[model samples]
Target: MKINGEVTTGLGKAAYFLSQEFYSLEFERNLGFVPFPGTLNVVVSDDYLDEINEIKNNCQNLIKPDEGFGAVKYIPAKLCDEINGAIVFPAKTTHEENYLEFIAENKLRDQMNLKDGDIVSLEF
Candidate 1:
């Protein structure tokens, strides 16, 4: 499956959470690379809302977090047909249905030269 969306800014909280040892260790073990301490926010186009919801509901590869944090489900994905990443669904996220969070080994914004409103494609 593939989806395209415009990049958006997030609340700037993921870095702190992602940097925690528990989560980073799990990500390294499961994803083969430790995620860059941040996420790339993509607001899915309205046309793909239903498909995004379907993936959210059906995703089973979960990363259980430590106490005080929430579990997250993730689907392995590729960004722009090049970067290896994952589409993450945090159980306690404040985001709406159209929002998709991506994590990769490198800081994607710099690596991809991304900014708000830039179009990015993810393939699962």
Candidate 2:
């Protein structure tokens, strides 16, 4: 499946959650590597929001909270053709359903040289 969106800024809080050892380990185990300490926020285009919702509905193998932390759902994704990543939906997120976060082994924004308002493509 493929999804397209515009790059956007986040609340700068992903590091607090993603940097936790519990979550990092779980992410590493699930995704085959420890993700960078942050996520890349993508605001779904209106034309593709419904498609993203459908993918979320059918996606399986979500990562659950260890104990105290919030839960998160994930769908495997690749960004910009070369960046291996995943679309992450946090149970306790500040973002709306139209917004999704991408987590990867490397810093996607830096690696891809993206900025807010830039167009991004995701292959899931």
Tens-place lDDT per residue, model 2, 1-124, is 7778889999999988899898889888988989899999998867777887787877785777877788888988998788887889787887888888999998887887899999988898
Poorest lDDT segment (10 consecutive residues) of candidate 1: 51-60
Candidate 1 structure quality by residue, lDDT tens digits, 44-96: 87888888788778887899988999998988999999999898888988988
Q: How displaced is residue 35 in candidate 1, in Å?
A: 0.3
Which candidate's lDDT is highest? 1
Q: For each candidate, how many residue pairs have backbone atoms clashing (under 3 Å)?
A: 0, 0
Top of the candidates by TM-score:
1
lDDT of each: 0.90, 0.86
Candidate 1 residue 29 Cα shift, in angstroms, is 0.8
Model 2 whole-model lDDT (C-alpha atoms): 0.86
